[model samples]
Target: MADLFFESIEGVKKPYIDSLQRLLKQLRSPFAEGDDVGIKLHWGERGNRSFLPPDYAREIAAWLMDRGAKPFVFDTTVLYSGGRRTAQDSLNTAASHGYTAEFLECPVIIADGMDGKNVVSIPAGYKHFPTVQVCNIFEQAKGFVIFSHVKGHMVSLFGGAIKNLSMGFASRAQKQRMHSDYHPVLNKKKCTRCGLCVEICSTKAATISEPEYPKYDLKKCIGCAQCIAMCPEMALQIFWNSDMTVFQEKLVETAAAVWKKIQNKSVVINALLNITEECDCLPGKNHIIGRDLGFISGYHPVAVDEESLKKTGTDIFEKAHPGIPWQRQFTYAREIGF
Candidate 1:
């Protein structure tokens, strides 16, 4: 068992600042004096207010700066279409959430470049991905502090420090690989063969045969799944198995790649506030599945997540998101020593 540091909300003598300070005190920072540290956290999506508070992030930044270190809060653009799909939009969203440099007393960086192209490919040597694309920011920083807002997820069942690194640190292309389990299978009966999918496909993966039906060359396909949405006749369908297990495994392997990038210069912080039934990416009122808890920090991502689940009475996320068990993340992370 790893040494997990925690501060319960009820036991906190003071409020946010005090709890944050105590948590920080218990965890050792990998950064040294004058080193640039990246504080990796999610900037809430548009219309979503369940992200980690800016004030708490500011307190961490201030603490780092006080230790003669240079700290900046940052996150990469998301893969799916949303307000945070582009680097500029992500920065704007962060600013809207009061994560501005002036407010945090530290600069904020959009890890991936303008079009989400800025990345460094690290060979993870995993079952799914031979290599994972990590944002350039992770390479630039001497250390990282992952601030995660714990919650339930549709695929992974629970989102915490592991998901934050696997999905959060990866570039858009790498994300496509992790989610490649669901290859689009065309429903030929419903296909009108309007050549819409052929026109929309960038890789020429979907091609029209002699008559009209579109033939998919899985070899050429990068698994982008762009053509699935372009089907006008609703002909495309996904193989809906619980592919989430493999997806979650690949997700953790990517986290291993990120952990390798930073070596031991990383910290995991999980804030058990506003424990929602779903992730923050979707825009809607999150149904509270678990009561507000406190915060936990640890040097190991897996340990922190294990402890977080334990404190929340264990299996809470599993109960909230049945059929999508999140334990695979920690199990794999530990197996790989990530």
Candidate 2:
């Protein structure tokens, strides 16, 4: 069997769902009958217009059920204040985006508990993280289908299966640890003092008085980048505390740690459709950078993401987020034997 499987949407007479069905048929399943499988995916932030519909997730869940493996769709709470900051808010957002149990034919849940306390620390032994913390679902599900949306990300250049396993499964505190390397720096010339940044800030770090420019309290900032990504005037830029590559390395380390535990019974799939210039975590209509390609699947997150990047081409992401050392994710993955 091929190490990677791809189904392109070009010139196909059938609908995209058919294409995905064909792709699913090609991949080998590692699951045994009656196993509990977790279909991990992002359901888009509230008000985001570019996220992939839940139709694909329904298909994946149905496929697992057909194979006699019970499946559930899940995502973890995020660090930033938004529709997904709390488990209840995240589930509500998921339901709003059509990820409800009735719609997807599976239970939708927050992997981390209601208050984000259900978590476990796993051994990473990597330079950045000697141990990585993530949702405590590793023992409950016998298998996982790492379904990720392939799109541009401001810090990582692109988001794919690697990111899905890393940030997607991370606990709120772990997410903050990975994000702590950078903070928002304002470009006063571009500042409109609209207070949008202050409004979107999850932490009280960003503040403004009646007529003063917005001030960022570095001590209070958790570096979730919500302010930087949602700044309407594009006034905020990333201020890295160390080499920017450190962030990429930390991302890979976390994913590698999770992969180590789940590698035996996990498959990775990257949906190359939507190919937007920004992640679905941001709440606006992001610019589409590539035409709707299709899907790619592989046994490893690194390989699947690398293939997704190749299919989409690096230039698109580089142009979208210049000067990011995204390649470090792959190189560091190899170094740590992930």
Candidate 3:
């Protein structure tokens, strides 16, 4: 069993800096004097209304600077199209989201290639993967810290450290493959068709074949989860991760690759405020579930995520995301040596 350090949700609104400092010290970071620490953060979209506040990040960075490590905010641009897809777009979006020099003292770099293809492979042993893409920022960093906001998802039902890294470090083509699980064959019994799915699909993967009936072409689909999120009649739903055991095992395994490479040089912090129902990558935000769980930091990504999930402890979690068990992350992680 890995050592998991935790603290309760308090002081997020006031004296956040002190709370942050307390947790960082407990984790025993690799922040030596004059180290260039990579502060990996998600700036959300160009106009997201609920991303992590810049003042908190700024305070965290300043704390590190005072402690001898030079810190700068960093994030990879999106693989899918949106506000953070391009380098120019990322900078613009960061500034728009209120991430100014007054807060973060470093520049954000897209880990994979600038085009979302630059990568080095870290061979990994998992139920689903033999190797994982190690991004440039990840490969070159002297130290890493993931400042993630815990949240629910329209697809996965939860997004934390694992999702943050998988999708975060993923290339454009990798995203297409991961989303391949969303090609759900519509259950005709549940079908009211309603034309909502066809309207939402970007590649025209969904079409109306008859009145109150819709058909899906898996080949044409890009797996955007648009039809799944827009359907009102409850007719549009797919098998969640048709091969979930392997998919999630691979998810945790990939996270392990990152953690193992960094060893004690990395820290996972969950800023459990503004807990939204969907990932920041999504175009719109939705419901909030469970009371806000506060900051948790640990050297173990698996341990940190496991600790974070236990903090939620809600019944709606499994129903919100069927067939996907967050606990499986640890089971697989342990087998693969996270």
The number of the candidate with the highest lDDT is: 2
* Candidates sorted on TM-score, descending: 1, 2, 3
User: Candidate 1 residues 145-242, lDDT tens each?
Assistant: 98898888888888888889888988765665677643668888989888877887788988997686888898888776556544545577644335
Where's the lowest-lDDT run of ten residues in candidate 2?
233-242
Report lDDT per candidate. 0.79, 0.88, 0.67
Off by over 4 Å in 2: 12-15, 181-242
Spell out the clash pairs found in candidate 3: 72-106, 113-118
lDDT tens per residue, model 2, 1-338: 26899999877643389878999999899999999999999999999989989989999999999999999999998866678878899899998999999999999989998867798999999898888889999878999999999999988999999999999998866776787655878899999999988997878999999899999999998766667645656687644345669889989999999999999999998999999999999998899999889999989999999888888999999998999999999998999898
Candidate 2 lDDT at 20 equals 88
Please, what is the TM-score per model?
A: 0.84, 0.83, 0.75
Worst 10 residues of 1 by lDDT: 225-234
lDDT of 2 at 305: 93
lDDT of 2: 0.88
Clashing pairs in 2: none
Question: Can you write out model 3's per-residue Cα lDDT over 125-173, one digit (the tens) per residue?
Answer: 6555566655667545678777777877655567778777666665543
